[model samples]
Target: MTVTQVALIKMPAGNEYFNLLTKAGIVFDYIALMWLLALTNGVLSPLFPIAYLVVMHATIYWRTKGAILSSISLTAGYSTIFAVQAQFDFNTTFVFILNLVFIWIIGVFGSLIVIRERKHLKQKEIFHELMFTDYLTGLYNHRHFQEQLRIMTRARQNFLLVMGDIDHFKQINDQFGHLIGDEILKNLGGIFRDLAEDYDAQAFRYGGEEFAFLLPSIEETRQISFFDDLYGRLSSEKFSKECLSVTMSFGIASSKSGILPDKLLGYADQLLYSAKANGKNQVKFESRYTYYYSKAKEEIAASKQ
Candidate 1:
């Protein structure tokens, strides 16, 4: 197979890595300890090398499962050394047993610390999700939307702001009860999720009955077909056993509007209001030049007068 295909095939199963770098560090530490043991053989205190051995195994235990392997390998290495020493003097056997016990104790304590650290990290992830996710629609919440706007503004990336709201959402709630209205919201959220994944966009549930999208790196010319497809899907969606159809109104503003993120949101929101005012189930989109041109013409007329 081609190199590219082989690389793809070898992709890790999960989003996390095994931390091969940490493993490499462990290997280096093992080699350094071996070198120290060789240099100090039958000269200095054997306890000095034992201290280094405990530290090396403890370091690996702090992060991963390397502790057990380190413990086993160190035990076997010391056993071999003591066995040779026993040919001359058997007194080194006591130190061998002590070495095994001390290294394992350090490994166990390091494993405990690693467990606690992982638990704390998992809790933080859960809290972050709760803080930034909308419970009802399972989409990014308004806080996350605001944060994303700030990030996009700082990065100076081009994006299109699309505001959408269900048409007569309150009427649907009043007519069919809030449950059906909720189902409609969920269905629309699902549609938005799929669209966002397909188009490399971010979708947010701005508030009750309102949703927003950030279409990153998309050109104005690419929006018309997307809006067309979106409207088609929304209009044809049936949310209830009665096969009730729902519609939504959208307003889109391009990055060419040259407005701040907050202003982009406000402008798109205003256009959405205009859609609702003119007629429901329609989209209203405008470039920055349209409003700028109108304002300039009005100023020119006023100056002439």
Candidate 2:
């Protein structure tokens, strides 16, 4: 019975079938105990109170309706044993009635405790979400970003850190307004969020107009393909009438063994600066290679002509 209780507690919640099976097991245990009491001709009657413990355990996962049903089932089973034994004396009858009342009371009280515990768990979840989430962009906040980076660094896990900044963001805000700029930022955040989901990566808003992506180590070709997709999507996004389009510059650095988190971030930041210096709306990597979108190259060539 102890092992059964432990297994039930360890089972993940919200599965109706599993819960039903556990409840059935508890009922079977009660029936078996009652059978023993009858076979012994009331010699084991003193052990009947163990039924209360079973009912109490059921109430943990069963909530109010389940608890009440479990109590009723136990009472019916016990009454059958009482009838079989023909124990109709005043003392036995009073003790049986008292036991039934205590079972109901314990079931109701145990359900109440379960409800309180659920509420506490929900509160904790909400608190954790607020702490780790960025309110404006809905990405992970900078604090979470730093913490995750530190964890990966401590574990010496290989990854790619890509730092991105919106190109000419201040100019856009000055030309249009902060509201339009904010909308642009929110849209870009959504794009990053989708990309993260697709790539099984983490994205964060690393302060104003800057974002970061932590991607698992992959082949160079795949990394370039990811950057190409990102650049294409950003170039196609349409903002307000005043602001036709926007672009971002990125700097990517691969993780190495024995490297500190701060140094990795700094190297990525430097690469980002290099992208901006060469021309906005491009990506620079630690390999000292600069990547440009095909359309961007054509546009640059056209402007030169």
Candidate 3:
């Protein structure tokens, strides 16, 4: 959530809230100076960003967009200053005057920090997004997909888990250049995402040419229809001139039972092998076969036809 949303949630809005926010804001200004007095334990050490208070204050002062809410958070964060201040008598205006002067100096530092923080925040957001995404396909990576599975299972939805493997993917890479193979993977990811995003289903890049789909709100017995629809979709989508319209072998398992994470995945893997063995471009469920290497060999032999 944005800082504004947080502020709105935590404090009442309007002039009354603004007053509390301003009080906190000023305390932030005061604390900045106090910390500089004994430079060691203060923000200047490892967390120099704290010393850059001028950036945050100035941004609020000029932007005025979330000024009130921002101040509320600033105040709440630095309110501990009251306890620290209680330790120092200072007993004079001298401390106050010095504090203001220190703030003025650091405002320059804050200005630099403000520009940099904006860029830093943008970078942080991108880094976090990349963590969820697969490099080969634009779909969510396996780690993120599994996380979603756990969340959905906890929510207790009737869901279909479809595991997909590209037919004869290694041969595609071997016959064509790896670069071309990669483009196919990337293209397929986009195709799957477009297909699933609207259905409240999620598509994921489980690794290499294997993708996963979680179709929520599926009825227990109608799970077969879900795979058939997906199979038809994949069979119909167009590809670039260099690439053929590829078919996927799918293993679909529906669970109202909601198995634990490891077991659920194991079941999906077994079903994936079943589909691969039964013949490429088919879907299966509840298949006990667990051998991937052998199933892959079967797929390779079948692909030559």
Query: What would the per-residue lDDT of candidate 2 be over residues 203-264, giving only the tens digit for each residue?
Result: 99999999999999987666777887788788788866778799889999999999999999
For each candidate in the order shown, give its overall lDDT on alpha carbons: 0.70, 0.84, 0.64
Give the C-alpha miss distance for residue 184 in model 2, angstroms: 3.1
User: Model 2, poorest ten-residue lDDT window?
Assistant: 295-304
Off by over 4 Å in 2: 1-99, 236-244, 295-305
Top candidate on TM-score is 2
| Candidate 3 residue-wise lDDT at 162 | 79
RMSD of each: 9.6, 7.4, 13.3
- Candidate 3 residue pairs in backbone clash: none
Minimum summed lDDT over a 10-residue window in model 3 is located at 42-51
TM-score-superior candidate, 1 or 3: 1
The local lDDT score (0 to 100) that residue 256 gets in candidate 2 is: 95
- Candidate 2 TM-score over all chains jointly: 0.67
Residue-pair clash count for candidate 3:
0
RMSD (CA, angstroms), candidate 1: 9.6
lDDT of 2 at 294: 73
| lDDT value, residue 143 of candidate 1 | 99
lDDT of 1 by residue, 1-305 (tens): 14433544576645254344434555666655655665666222464455445555555445446567677767666666556545344445556566668777766676666677778999999899999988878889999999998788767778888898988888888888888888888888888888888788999999999999989755544565567557666657777874378877888876643458878788899988888787767777775322221143354455458
What TM-score, computed on C-alpha atoms, does each candidate reach? 0.64, 0.67, 0.55
